[model samples]
Target: MILIANSEAWPGFSKSIECLRRGERAVDALVAGICEVEREAKVRSVGYGGWPNMLGRMEFDAGVMDGATRQVGAVGAVPDTLPVAALAREVMRRLPHVMLTGDGARRFATELGFPIDETLHPDSKRVWWERLQKELSPEALAAFPDIPLAPLSHAITDPERVRDNTVFLGRDSAGDLASVTSTSGWAWKYPGRLGDSPIPGAGYYADSRFGAAACTHTGEMTMRCGTARTIVLALRLGHSLRQAVDLAVEELKDLRDGFIGGVVIHAIDADQTHRVVSLNCEEPIHYWFWQEGMNEPEKRAAERV
Candidate 1:
């Protein structure tokens, strides 16, 4: 099994993977572990203290994918819920629909016995109130000479970028894959805004018969370019994983808003040939591996482009 998650709280995610390898169920392990990390770090894009929406409300989104069967379940725009990860799992289990959103998502969560609360976290509330106070003060207007003060201006402008958490677990066999992605969207975004994180084939894609890949950061570019799918298609067309990622990044580079952030990919071939690629503005593409023969994971963080 292999796992890759993006968070400042890496230790917890790493520990969770270890526990899952021990005996815990995969879904349960992932949700519990991630939630625990979120609680501890108070990251403002996941559970509990996540960022609020434009309306000063908090809504979360998450998704899980089963590579074996190519199945996916997702929820968007939910508020004040634990196990937001579980909600994604439930979508994979109960609903025939691939995705749910807004009030509908909230209703479904409640129906499934997930509790809802008007208040999310004290930190989120405090941030919202503090921003409100700042906006209301006459000093704010005087401090900014050109920009005008308004509810929408301060509320929705420049929504905070939330880091997503992703995990991929599967055997070393040539054809086996599994993956998940969870996020809270952008902080202070529009009420119903949705990003690539919960969108199938955009934020993530996996297939045991084909390969697996999950992406994070720059959802807008990923969605427009169909980046995850593009990478997979590139590999299927005979490009190596490294070549595919480089090509994908190159394709997006010339576009107006292309490839603004980073992407992480894990791919394994039928022969158990595996590759991991981490691409970002500041770092050149690199690879890592934990193979059957290797006693520990080997990382090659630097390579000439």
Candidate 2:
């Protein structure tokens, strides 16, 4: 068994590895792992105390894929819920729809026994206030980064300096593959905006016949290119894992000179081989990796190209 996740998922590494060791399905292990991170109230990028939208309301997004069965589920723009990834799994098992959003998502989750509340974490609220003071324009009561002076104008300054998302993929002992992605979307983003995390074939994809791939960072570019699915399809076409991921990164280069904010990929092939790639990101993108032969999960870093 093998599992790989971005650094934000480090808190859940041991638990996820335990699931894999017990011969759990890859999908189960993936969700179990991400739930740990989601439950953490201190992480500003996902769940609980995560950063809020520009309107100072917390919203969440999550997605999951079961490669063995080709079943998928997703939820976006959900408010006041932390275990969205698990809710997504429930969606895969029960709901007829592939995605749900906003109050509708909250209602569905509540009907299905997920938590619901209108309270915001104190820290998250504080951060939202700080952002308002720094980024909001009193004249318009809108974030400076979101204003438009004219059609097709480049007047709006980008507020996002860096973005983070948690994406994980696993191959179980039985060779079944699965993936999950979760995030609070871009910090101080427009209310009701959904990023690649909740979009199938954009931020994540899994197919037991080929492999699984998950993406993080600058969700817009990934959404536009359907990068996660592209990587897996490249593997289906006989490209090496490294080659496929590299090519996917190449597609995002036009965003800004040769960078697209930041991008990272975690991938595994049917043969159990794994690869990680980063674009315009910090060097040595950290991730947790564990396989059958390892004594314990290792905190490894993948060099960005």
> Among all windows of ten consecutive residues in candidate 1, which has the lowest summed lDDT?
166-175
Q: Residues 1-305, candidate 2, lDDT per residue (tens digit)?
A: 88899888976778888999999998999899898898787665777647776666788899999999889999999987888899888888998989989888889888988767553678767866765565446864454545542321222222434367798899898889999988887776667878899898899999999999998887878987889999999999999888888888877774554225778888999988998877778545888888898998888887677
Please report, in order, the local distance difference test score of every candidate based on alpha carbons. 0.60, 0.82
- Which segments of model 1 are wrong by more than 4 Å? 8-12, 19-41, 117-119, 135-175, 257-305
lDDT of 1: 0.60
- Residue ranges of candidate 2 with Cα displaced over 4 Å: 117-119, 136-162, 254-259
lDDT tens per residue, model 1, 1-305: 54444433342455555545665544455555555644543555565656676567777777777666778888887776656657887888998998988788888889989877543676776776666555556775455433443455335433344544444433423234555666666666667777776777777776666666666556767777776677667777887777777776776565664336655554544344555555553545433334444445444553322
In angstroms, give how far residue 236 of model 2 lies from its true place: 0.9
Model 2: number of clashes?
0
